[model samples]
Target: MAADPTHRAIEAVFRIERARLIATLARMTRDVDRAEELAQEALLSALTEWPKSGVPDRPGAWLTAAAKRRLIDGARHQSMLERKHAEIARERDAETDMSAEAIEAARDDPLGDELLGLIFAACHPVVSPEARAALTLRLVGGLTVEEIARAFLSSEAAIAARITRAKKAIAKAGVAFEVPRGAELRARLGSVLEVVYLIFNEGYAATAGPSLVRPPLCAEAQRLARILAGLMPEQPEVVGLLALVEIQASRLAARADVDGRFVPLTEQNRARWDQLLIRRGLNALDRAEALGGTDGAYVLQAALAACHARARSAESTDWARISALYDRLAEVVPSPVVELNRAVAHSMAFGPEAGLRLVDDIANAALLRNYAPLPAARGDFLFRAGRTGEARAEFEAAAALAANERERDFLLARAAACAP
Candidate 1:
């Protein structure tokens, strides 16, 4: 069934402008919860009004103005009920002027990056890492709780509770709703970048969904990365993170086929990759290295992506260099996941047997016990080594543990291929 064109247009406008709207209101109200409610009211207003009247030429500004009016009306009602009515009445005119001026300033001034402030607020150190990502997706990415849950492969109720707890943590900590400066900014950046990359990874390979990729979520993450780059041009890690996302996004179009089957990087047609994004990524990588970010975690990962981007064919790729880069990445940010990836790289550069040995070493790591990728990588090595029986069992195990439908299907097909 075809969706209503009008509704689709409205939805697109809301998705693009939602962060800005929430940020602007948050700045004025100094209350994230209240700001979100006002933003929702503005959206409801748009749904009711835009259909009757044509969509406004400046929809963002229109939404902002609508939310502003709601804020004013709420203040007016509160003033009427309070014993301090006289005090509130005296300040009403000044409050109205300030709200308009701030909204306008946010639109014109580069320094008034409200969305960045909102992101910093969501990524406050007080929030748990898992909850930080969930809250950021809700407030900055404008993803619904259900969408966030699917992306994280968690139950909707759990995601909701995490978001609730995160908001309370922020309020309890009395975190200011503004971007930090100097040392404070540096301290907060790591958390912000981690959450942004987490968002991009979910979009790169949806954790649990019918679709293999979620382009809108990927775009949102990239938008946030680009915002960070603009605000901190001198931060090498920031630039490197931007480069990493750009390079990864270039392969998005080729990640799936006409029938929506997952296509491995080595199997994808190189010509289908976005050349513009590849160039952008490579340029950003060069800038990061020039700024003395050669050994940063993000810089190392960008270098690894660059190795693939530079290759005309998978066979021509410098697997030796890639394995070396993975070695550095593991040292910089050790994890069971990195070990699993390093094993794959070792297999590519050396042999299936070499990779299999590495995988076996980490096979008992607690984190990899139920991680589908662990068995999936093992299955690939076994298949390449002509151990069909073992390969099939590993693939089947991976499929059983998989959360995403598309990924499960791909693994099951691999298992079938290992049959006699």
Candidate 2:
């Protein structure tokens, strides 16, 4: 069945401005769920109106105003609920004479700022990290429960439950809708960065899809990162994440072959890399460093990417420096993924044997049991060390474990290359 054009357009617009729409509604209504409801209502209205009236000159602003009206109507409808009645009465009285111009003006300036504040609020530390990620993706990334589930490789039911629980947790904990100040701001910023990075990473390398890249997610995350950087110029990690994404994204053109086959970093054509994006990435990284603080996870990751970017050729890559940076990153962040990457770096810097040993140590790590890359990395090292049979087996295992079709095909090809 074909998707309705109006529905698809509404989806596209919502994807682009979901964060701002929800942020504005949250500020006005002071309830996250209600704000989302209003935003959804506005989308439905657009689906009805846009096909007939055509898309508005400023679709975002139009949606914002429509959502605002829905909220107002909802508030008025609920005015009979005693305590709610007084709140609505007060808010209505406050905006009794609100003109179209006044409303438009209000939606323009502080509203956008408040929307960003709402993003920070939604990602507050009090929320569990998983919940934070799920909620941010739902509200800000504008992803459906099924889409979010697919991204995480979890069941749709599980994803829905997580989002439901997250919203309930926020309400139960009485989390504010406003942005934090001072130290609280710093802590919340970390959570926000994590959400943004997660979104970008998913886009850059979808865990399970026919397509190797999800460009929309990448563009959305980059947009959010840029907005955050602009809003908080002095925040080093914000700049760091932007830099990291930009640098990594610079290689997008080279990351795949002409037929959309996956191309590993070692095999990518350097000439196809976007120099403009690389330069922007470097400048952002410089800003992050200039802010003068201990490097965050994103900053460290960016530094590692910079090592690759500075190399004119794959052979000139400073594997030792990358290994050292990964070492520092592991000490700070300490994830199995970092350990896996560090092993790869060690192989490049030292020898395949050294990397193989490190991979052996983590072979049984619970976190990496289903992670295809572990076996894939081990296969690469084994192949390099002339252990053809072992490399073939590892690559086959990786192919079985991989979720994305493109990655599976890549691993299978590698496995076939090792066939006697």
Candidate 3:
């Protein structure tokens, strides 16, 4: 029998072309959100039409041309005032640029950085940081709302609503759909980095999946970081973020066991780390520091990761230096998550009670209430302090809160170890 195109294959097509499709459509339609809608409409057409007609050889080009045809048809059929008609007609002419070669250009980014522009467009400061993260992951990362919801430990409806609001917010603010330059570029780069790292962190430590890491998402974030670094080699912070993710990615093998259970950094086999990635990460960090990014959040964090990558054993790891880096990190990006990490570093450096004090101080904060790491850190400190019963309780709470099955199982195992 001849091979046939499956839905899964078609979806892979969408994932690969997602960023370019939205970028091309947004450029043509002069609207980011509408571009997403039209892209989906084209996908729908494919879903219905391709199974019967067979998959087109150039799926990306086909989707682009299909979406442009829809715009042309809508413009032709809709009634409008003379000026409005002329405007739509002009738009049609512009869309004709989305022919085979144009679609190929959009896909290839032949002469410009369309995807990067789309990244800035989705992450424009007009929307809230939360919205920017959600929208960028959607449009640029090619993630569905459900996947984002699971990563965030939030509801799909909430993510959907935030995406809707973000589009409207971008429209209302009249944020330009192009990459900024000069000082504006620096200011916008922070938001862009945050979105990219959010995607990376989700991949590094997935919240609600059977496995501990999602390689595809992690790879996607790294790819974006590399592209950014290529496009702007002089930017210290961009290089810093790239360094941080690269070093962290090197340890993926040691993050889990043969059965895919969670493995603490202290227990992971150091020999399993990827040397190439470590070299790249260290080189990137050296570049960042050479460019005077010592105080940057990502550079500081990369420094912290370097402490471990250089160590031959867990006991040889510099907990005191890591604690200091966390201390500086807390000042740079103050939050319960940062505080929790700092407390763990403190416990490793100054003993458990010192860290316990800090953890207890933020124990009741609303944001930390359901956050698994807060209790997990507390449990680790309590266990080290010989307060087994209290540690067991915290462990149980963390297990209950954990979203990843592997992480939850690991927590439960720790709780059992503390049984009196």
For candidate 2, list the clashing residue pairs, or say none.
none
Pick by TM-score: which candidate is best?
2
What's the candidate order when arranged by decreasing lDDT? 1, 3, 2
Candidate 1 vs candidate 2, lDDT winner: 1
- Model 2, CA-based lDDT: 0.83
Candidate 1 regions exceeding 4 Å error are 1-18, 39-73, 76-108, 128-131, 143-162
The stretch of ten residues in a row with the least summed lDDT in candidate 3 is: 77-86
lDDT score, candidate 3, position 351: 99
TM-score of each: 0.81, 0.82, 0.77
Candidate 3: C-alpha RMSD to true structure equals 4.9
CA lDDT scores, all candidates in order:
0.88, 0.83, 0.85
True lDDT of residue 133, candidate 1: 87
Say which prediction, candidate 2 or candidate 3, comes out ahead on lDDT.
Answer: 3
**Model 2 Cα shift for residue 365 (angstroms):** 2.3
Count of backbone clashes, every candidate in sequence = 0, 0, 0
Kindly list the per-residue Cα lDDT of model 3 for residues 1-420, writing each as its tens digit.
124547777777877887888888887777886788889888888878888888887888889888877776666766364565457767766656766667666567653467778888888888888898889878887878998887676799999999999999887877776778889998998999987888788889987768899876688789888877876677889999999999999998899999999999999999999989999999999999999999999999899899999889999989999999999999998988888888999999999998999898888888888899888899999999999999999999999999899999999999999968
